[model samples]
Target: MRELRIRAGYETLGELHRASGVTVATLSRIESGVQIPSPKTLNRLAPFLKVSVEDLLAAAGYLPEKEEDPNEAAARTIEAAISDDPELLEFWQELVKRDDLQLLFKQVKPLTPKSIKKIIKVIKAIEDAEATED
Candidate 1:
């Protein structure tokens, strides 16, 4: 929510009211997620919040981004940034998508082709012996 407030240049409820002409109670309720504004209210609030009206759906988890939270908030910031970045598109194309099994692969680069051949040979020997005896 800090991000929204910062973008709107509103540090206080009074600032929100002054900038957008919304009543303090209404703005407070909206910010606190106690009330979901109607479309017209949202349209007025969006410019005041410096966010899109669609971003006001807090009941549906349309959270105003708070950059102070290190984990979830930071993750959302990165996602929003990546979706907007052009250079990141090239980098993403070169890299595989991050997923559960492959997450460690991103931190650890793979071995050379020669080292892979040696590893594959050990696997083949193990398989061949298993097939012959078992």
Candidate 2:
């Protein structure tokens, strides 16, 4: 985790703290092996580190590492990418209920992280715009 953060250009704990809002002290403890982050913290940090929460959880030993079905993994990855907040999850779930949206996913069986991030940003921008107009 520490290596990932550093490679992501968060060269110092303070830098990671500023980006993630997870406090330098807590990050310090986690990197030093003195503490393990809870799932929520891992969720908060994963996107900033350009990693998936499942990977982070597996690395932290909170989840077992095992082979996953490619289709299922893609779905989970998309869901995780949109789960930065409750509003995003609500929006994603709504989209999931649409048959047309499911068909789109079938067409793009697998999505890259960059594509997923772009989707997330678009959705978030829409959400923010809606909130302000309300």
All models, RMSD in angstroms: 13.7, 11.4
- Candidate 1 TM-score, C-alpha based: 0.41
Local accuracy of candidate 1 as per-residue lDDT tens digits, 38-87:
66777787777777766665423555544453433333333344554455
Number of the top-ranking candidate, with lDDT as the measure: 2
Model 2: colliding residue pairs: none
> Which numbered prediction scores highest in TM-score against the true structure?
2
Error of 2 at 26 (Å): 0.3
Off by over 4 Å in 1: 1-3, 57-134
| Whole-model Cα lDDT of every candidate shown, in order | 0.59, 0.82
RMSD in angstroms between candidate 2 and the native structure over all alpha carbons = 11.4
lDDT of 1: 0.59
